[model samples]
Structures are given as C-alpha cells and as structure tokens.
Target: MTAEPILTISGLNVDYGTGANGVRALRDIDLTLHRGEVLGLAGESGSGKSTLAYAVTRLLSPPGVITGGDVHYHRPGGGEPVDILSLTPDELRAFRWQELSIVFQGAMNSLNPVHTVHSQLTDVLTAHRPGMRAAERTARAEELLTLVGISADRLAAYPHQLSGGMRQRVMIAMALALEPEIVIMDEPTTALDVVMQRQILRKLVELRERLSFSVVFITHDISLLIEFSDRIAIMYGGRIVEQAGAAEIYRDPRHPYSDGLLHSFPALHGPRRELTGIPGSPPHLSAMPTGCAFHPRCGKAFEPCAERVPALAPPDAGQDREVACWLHH
Candidate 1:
C-alpha cells in the first residue's frame, strides 16, 4: 500500500538575487515525500539536487537564497504542520536538525574531527530529546550504533579514527537519533566504493523498513536510484523535466533528458543499446535559454520547445506521471 505524504512541496521557485543580478536555482519544482518512501532526485553535477535538499531542510545560507516556494511538512503524530519557507529565524532554529534531518554529500568532513562519537551523539540527543538522562542517552546512542550495523563500543573513537563507510554510518545514526519523520540524504554514498555503497544502501533499506521515515534521496547515479527509490525526478538546469515510478522511468523515459539518461546506462539484461551522453553542459542560471530550459541539449527539440516552457502534468502514460517537455506537454 502507498503511504500518505509526510511532506509536500509545490511551485517552489528559489532564486539567488534580485533585478539583473538574479540567479534562479529552482523553477517551479514540485515534489512529495511519504512515510516509507524514497523519492530520488537524479541529475548531473550542479543540477540543483543539493539545492532542493537544503531548501526543504531550510538550510540554505547567504547569497544562495529561496526567493519563493512553499515547503509544507507534516510531522508524525500531528505535532505541527509547517510551511518550511515561511518561518522566522527562531522557529527555523527549532525546526532544523530535530524535526528535519539531512545527511550531506561529504559526511566525512561534516563529522566533527575533534569530538568523539559519544560526545557527538549526545549533542543531538541533548538538543532534541532532553527528557533522556545521561544513562538513557548513552543507551539510545548505542542502539543507534547497532542499528547502523556498527559496534557501540566505537562511540569512544573520534571521527578521524573511522573508515569512510564507518563515518557515513555514524552520520546516518546521528540523523536518526531524533527519529525525525523525514531525512534528506544528499549523495550519502558518493565517497564510498561499490561494495561499501551496496552495504550502506542495504542498511538504509532495512532501517527505513524498521523505522518508517520518508526520505528524499539525491544522487547522480540513475542505476542506483532505480534499484532503491520508489519514484524519481530528473532535473535539468534548474527545472525538473521528468518524474515517475522508478521501473516505469527506466522502461519508458518520456523527456529528452530522461531518455538520454537511460541511453547512458548499461542495462544488466538486454541487447546492449548504444551509449550516448547528453551533449551540452547545463546552462548557467543567470543566462538560461528561452522557453524550455533543456531545449539546447534536447535532440528532439523543435520551435514550440524554444518558444514556450512546457507545463508539468500527467504524461501520456495514462497514469500518475508528469514530465515538462513539449512531447508530453
């Protein structure tokens, strides 16, 4: 059974500056996150994957700002329904790290080099679940460590002392300490080798089943996304061009960019299709092309694509699928 959404974001347009200095990072992006679901946002480098993640968590800082958007979140057990975009600094301070959690790309650096794992774990527990005593906190942290398949004894070790995979596990453990309903993981396994990546993803799958929190998983690996995610949204430049179920996406990609992505990957059981990468680099946000943002790199482009931006809606799948492309418009 499909779970109801825990978070919903609609018509989210995040821009950097004002007047001529403006840089648009996201263009009318819409997405949803439900309990026990992994929604993968897949794109190339600088495709606003991380930007969307940070924006959802209200972690965007400085020159990189959210000009307009509505990020609505439904915390578990009916505590509060929050519009993440419309919060004061004080409210935001209370919301972050506790209500919403994110595991950033380079977690090795994000982990404190100076503090031991125990101290670090205690910090989060103290911040969110203050009701827990010293002994209780220690016990809780141990349980988290075991959940990530690591020995709780290593809580005495410093972040610098652990391997890349171990550090990544620690980050996951800390993020789950609060038992937040949603966790946004930004390429959490990018630094690990193939073996470690599989192991970590397996653990994540297991934990999601055990704990039942929603996840917005951002990554460049389409293959991995197909394996792990329930659905996927493919981003190009600053806009999401295509989004659908993972299996359907791989089987029949609608947008030109998504088609290109399918062509780029080598399918495990099939006659080898000719591999082809999308030709041009992504456009600069400040100087995006007219109409559809992906037209320049889209091989199936025509005049209408260059003249008007396509709306995102149910594609020709006769199902709940949407793609912002002239063909599917």
Candidate 2:
C-alpha cells in the first residue's frame, strides 16, 4: 500500500442523545485509510464498528450525533483536504456517491423489492450524471453488472428473482457504479455461507485491484480480516483497542483483548488449539464502566487500568503498531 492517505479521521466521538443521559457510542476514534488499501475493522457486536462507519459517511440517523471529530477527504495530488463534517446537504449529496460509497449491512434486504436491477443501477447514474443519455445509462448499468461477475441478462430481474449472493453483488456493483475513491463496506457478506462469503470477498479484492479504490471493510470475523486486509483495527467498547498490520496482529497481538479475539478463532493450518472466547459480554452503552472499558473483561488488567483510560499509542518508539492498554503503556 502507498503512504498517501485518502481519508483521515481524528478524535471522532459519537453519542446517541444529548446531555448527560446520552449514551456514548464512539469515543476518540483516530483512523486513516491509505490509497489503494483495504483496512479491516473487527470486533464483537456494538463495538462501534458500524457506528464509526455511519459517522464517517454522515449517515447516522435520528438521536445519533457526532459529538466531536474531523473527517477529512484528501483529494488526489494533495490540495486542501475537504472537511467532511462541514459539507452542506447539497454538497454532501454530490460528495457521497462520487467520492465515497457504502454497501450497507444486509445487502440482500437493502435492494428494492419492486424495482429491477437495471432500474436501481441506472437510478444512480441518472441522479449523478443528469446530462447522460438513456442509452449511455443503460450501457453503464449493464457494464456494472458484468463488472461484478453478474450477467447483463439478469439486469431485468427483480430482487426476489436473484439469489442472495447475486443481490449482494448487485449492491457492490452499485457502490462502484460511480468509481468512487473510497468504499465503506459494512458487513457486506453477512448471512451468506462461507463459500459465498469467500467468493464475494475475493471478488471485492479483485475489483479493488482493477479500480484502485480504497476500502474500509467492517466485520465480526477476525479470521477473514487477517486473510484479506492489509491492516486490521480491533475495536472494543466504543474505542480502538489495537491497530496493526494483519500478519503482525495474527502473530503477536499487543492488547489483551486483541489476544483473546485472536484465540477465539480456530487456526486452519497451525497446530490444533482450544478456543477460549472472551470471558464476558460487551459492556452496555448506557451503563459503561469507569476508566478503561475493556478492563472488566481483560485478564491482564492491573491497578492503573481501572483508574485511567490508556491512550492508544505505539509500545515501542519506532513501531507501527498502536494499542490502548496499561500493560503496554
């Protein structure tokens, strides 16, 4: 991956309501997506993975508000970065599909049941490129379907007529229709069988190679992230607990939570080992614990862990890895 950053998020915070009663959904998030690289986000449910995605994309709905943060889109050739949080509604609409697109979770249900695939695909083009002729839109729609390995002949098919995998592929096709610089996929392969999941992920990697677009892939499966992503960020209790290269994290995780997560999944090639999942369930957002959020479940917690939250920083002065834990600090 290149050193140039395509997107930068710093000090991001999100809440579900206003005032002291509000639930803190995300806290002090800092992440960077480099050009032409897949950055994987892995954690258990309610780890703020989806919240981070929605916050960055400016798609968070009612009661959910971005309390503080800056999300900057670094255009090619390094001009002044666009402040994503400052865009007006009109500008945000224009910015979304053209610069960044997202394939939401449960893509199968995301599609319109009444509309045919062709109509849905062409709708994006018609809205974005109003001057384009109908014939051109049709051609582009067909091409997009073909790009995702779906035959053009299925363009007229409704969502119900298509298989689950095909519907997911159609969603991917739509996300890439405008050739955006960044694509955020929030559990795009959810509910699919393992074989189908692998097929879809492989196709995404291939498409990224051909199109040269960066991706932020979010999932609960750490194994899949380790297999496909260039780097992995592990989230827990609304904060980033660890961030490192996928192989580095797999070989040696710095955070106790990350270690537990790695051990939760079975190895396919290495010697057989027991799977001891994380000891406790994730903390409730409304009633979060004091100090470090993971301290309650962390096996290696110490005196300082419960008194103060650990900053996410590199353990060694020159290392690229970052972990939020008193053990490393």
Among these predictions, the greatest TM-score belongs to: 2
Write one digit per residue (lDDT tens) for candidate 1, span 126-241.
87777889999999999999999999999999988999999999999988998877889999999899999999999999999898888889999898999989999999888888
Instruction: Find the 10 residues in a row with the least total lDDT in model 2.
Output: 293-302
Which pairs in model 2 have colliding backbones? none
Model 1 segments beyond 4 Å from truth?
A: 1-3, 77-80
lDDT of 2 by residue, 215-310 (tens): 999999999999989999999999999999999999999998888988998899978999988998999999888889988998888899888989
* lDDT (0 to 1) per candidate: 0.87, 0.95
Every model's TM-score:
0.95, 0.99
| Candidate 2 CA-lDDT value | 0.95
lDDT of 1 at 58: 75
